[model samples]
Target chain A: MGKYLPKAIVHSDEIDRLLAVEPGWTKKKSGVEKRHYAKSETASDMGAEAVKKALQNADTTLDEIDAIICTSGTMEQPIPCTASLIHKKLAPARPIPAFDINSTCLSFVTGFDLISHAVANGTYKKVVIVASEIASVGLNREQKESYVLFGDAAAACVVETADEETTGILAAKMETYSEGAHLTEIRGGGTKYHPNFHHNEQDFLFDMDGQKVFRMSSKVINPFVDELLQEADLSIKDLKAVVPHQASGMAMRLLQKKLGIPSSQFINVIENYGNTIAASIPLALCDAIESGKIQRGDHVMLLGTSAGLSLGGMIFVY
Target chain B: MGKYLPKAIVHSDEIDRLLAVEPGWTKKKSGVEKRHYAKSETASDMGAEAVKKALQNADTTLDEIDAIICTSGTMEQPIPCTASLIHKKLAPARPIPAFDINSTCLSFVTGFDLISHAVANGTYKKVVIVASEIASVGLNREQKESYVLFGDAAAACVVETADEETTGILAAKMETYSEGAHLTEIRGGGTKYHPNFHHNEQDFLFDMDGQKVFRMSSKVINPFVDELLQEADLSIKDLKAVVPHQASGMAMRLLQKKLGIPSSQFINVIENYGNTIAASIPLALCDAIESGKIQRGDHVMLLGTSAGLSLGGMIFVY
Candidate 1:
């Protein structure tokens, strides 16, 4: 596991200066003080940097990786999945399979769901999953309410088949509700609005209804997490940490309270990092591991809600 | 098992009038006579229509699908992963997981590889793999050589866990050479050159070095197909059909001659519809099945070279 954050920090106090509007209101509303922004870096570049760190932490070489699965919410280019470019940077000599799996912000969890199955089935030896986001470049200034909640960051994980003696994923599930797909989206840059056809700057950027996402997520997340634990034959008491997506400070607090997970056991990093889109859960898990909050043989829950009005949760052992 | 193509047809000869290039040059250069273009449809709209046909062919309903994995090279929107919108169109009442997996033109094979693994593991009961492309909208007339080769189309397949008594996938492999990642790309819509940063129409459209891609693909495709058969414990003699990606007329011809596959077994539709990117292989396979060229119990080879300078081959029973 490894994480990377760009150096350009923009505090909520600076939003007014940048957007020429009121500032402190964002922090007061979302609890995000400051967030990192990329300086001349593309999403794939950030992803490649994170992969190098992950390989080092795993004590593995790039060539040992059978596949590179990129789950980035924002891509470096529209063609040739970002994973290919990451593979070029990480292991140019190795002809490994590479592709992109996207479910917006929940992309990493979806990638994990697929990779875990492939690894467990003995179809792949090692797979590197990287979720990178350069949200600063796409943030809509007019939509400061949602813009202030996002930050630029990348996280990567090296997954391999776990032996019988080792603890591995016990249960995993992914579900989506398209009814809320429009709640978070970038309306342009695709076939629907090819630059030749519809050219609107704001349409090319991110938009979200934060309050609606919170209300919608609240309805299903508790049951989603509970069902995961039940399927894994475990209880919340056994969980050392529930590393939920670092979406928003308020959302995380509400989720933790609704699920009855202790603040000590709930991994939260939105204050310092903001919502790093797909990279959120992995980055939070890295923080938990480095801080010694989660130890080997401890049960941990990987959970999140995504743009597709999606809910996914996985119970696994560290 | 089913497919759908748009009604609007734009012929190659018409390209000269539309772009004011030259008459009969597109066909003489790329062997493309005509192609389809979506009139008022988005990529997801085309994909949902295809999914409906696939469901009917499979004698299944939209709600029966456990997952919708869209592998479209071109998307309807920049966010929400295209599949979610397609799900909304196809199964609004069902809350199934939907996402997109992209490897450019080879996206379908990649989706199939993942879906097969998940189905085999019983992680998903019924998954709909859709490869939809609206390349006509992205074609850059300034780059006529590559532009003339693209067409609009969509194809889909309904896959479930195969019973032990039924024949399913024998072997599958997907490999990429990111060294050629820049060979074929749409550079603008994403973070590297977001519409907000670089708003040039050409920057948002397709770019390609056809000769270089041909040289690069020629190096690996033969072995890619051969190894797939070898892993499946079969040979070219045992193959009933070879459905290659409908990239171009000359490229397909050269590939067939090199592989020693008879024209009787080789499937080609580039003349009528041009290259449809990710939709090519499945569309060709669907044609083969409908035409009775590939029958039940027959061993068919699905092979393609994608924009990532990628090569993928899947030998399975029809």
Candidate 2:
């Protein structure tokens, strides 16, 4: 796993000052100080960079990739899937099929689960899952609470089968509660509110009821994680580490406590990267590996709650 | 398979008069004389309706669905995957996973391929795939040529392994050529041209180089379909029917001539439905089955070319 962050770093304090928010608001509310924002770079461009770095980290070349799956919450274009653009820059000569899986913030894990099934069914060999988000582009500066919790970044991973049975995804679960679907949304750009229909400027920006999402996730996350562990016939203690979506520092803490995982066993990067949407999990995984929190032959769990009011968990052996 | 077309019917003649198009121009060019448009229904609403009809058509209940895969070229909301919204309307009490697979117009086939792989891998028991497109909302009146070729419709399919080995997907192939990615696109509402940044109304509407797409598809479709049949150890004669993406009547005729398939084997509903984007394939399939062109145990092929400059083919026993 590898991550590519934009060079133009914007501090939350700066935004707070501009919005006339109290000093230290973002840090205290979300544990985010500064985050990167793409300047003259699209999500696909960032994805291409992340994919290149991921290939290098994996010690592999583009031709080795059998397919490309772009799971980003934000896409560069509304026509061609972002994966196609990323592939053009990464492996233009290869005829590998590319598409997109979008489940908002949980897109990466959902994509990983799909890739795992495809690999198990012998449909693919080396699949590259790239999740690049340009959240800053849609951030509502007026909605300071949610805007300050987002950052632009990308992460990619080359996944393949392991030599041992102990490796690979052991158990996975995904569920969406659309009853809370309106909790977080971008009202425009989709069919419901087309730009041609003369929608308000705010309709085009990100809107969120952060408290509702948090409350709903709190009620579901614990039971969902426990059931997933039980179904896999493993206990939380057996996991070497848990790499969760870096949604917010407070959310991560709550998840850590709810899952009964020690603080040391949880990977948290929200303090720096903020909520990178679909890239959060893989980015956290990369952070865990680089910091030696996750090692070979260890059991690690990737979990997250997405904007769809969707919760997903996947346990795997590294 | 099932489709939900809005009650409101709009003929090309009406559009021609509205856009000051030459009388009979649309039918002469694309064979789209009349098509349905959603007067008030949204993509997700149409998708939900389609899913309900699909469930009834498949004689399955909501709880029987293991997952809901939304593969529409247009979505209802930007945050929650359309699958989640459809799932909310279809089975609010169920905890089944919901997500999206997007590859522009080819999303349905791409999603079907993924669902087939998942079912084969035992990750899912039954899946509901819904493709709903509200193309009417994004139609650029200025681009009268492509605009008049599209309609708003939704299609859904319930997929599971067949009771016998003679059924299910027999062979599938998907390939993308990124060089033609810009041939068809909606330049706004995405990261490349965020709605937050000022953009022209036309930028948010669909744009296409029809000639370029036709030339590219002509160069690739025949060879790709032939290779797919060869790899599957089957011939064109083995297929009882070929349900293709009803992009246009002329395009379908060209494909039939190029592939050497008889007109009787080809399924075209463009005259009534126009190009419903991702729903075109499944919608055509349902039309074929209902019209008795495709019968159970018959080998049927679903093939199409998408905006990614991608071509895909899947032969399956009906």
Q: Report the C-alpha lDDT of model 1 over A182-241, residue by residue, as the tens digit.
A: 998999988888777776889988999888988887877778777888899999988989
Q: Which stretches of candidate 1 lie over 4 Å from their true place?
A: A20-23
Q: Write down the C-alpha DockQ for each prediction.
A: 0.81, 0.81
Question: Please, what are the lDDT tens digits per residue for candidate 2 over residues B1-318?
Answer: 888998889998898788887999878877898999998887888999988888898999887889999998877877778888888787777778999999999999999998788888778989999999988888888887898899989999999987768787878889988888889888888888877685688899899999999998787777798888987789999889988899988888888888889988888889999999999999999989888889888999899999888898898888
Looking at model 2 chain A, report the run of 10 residues with the lowest lDDT sum: A161-170
- The residue-level lDDT of candidate 1 at B129 comes to 93
- Model 1 lDDT at residue B193: 83
| TM-score for candidate 2, residues paired by index | 0.98
Candidate 1 per-residue C-alpha lDDT over B1-318 given as tens digits, one digit per residue, 9 for 90 to 100 = 888788998887788787787888888777788888888777888899898888898899876789999998878888889998898888766778999999999899988988788888888888999988888888888887888888889999999976664679999998888899899898888888877777688888899998999998888877888788889999988999999999888889899999999998898978888899999999989888888999989999998988776898899987
The 10-residue segment with the lowest total lDDT in model 2 chain B = B191-200
TM-score of chain B of each: 0.97, 0.98
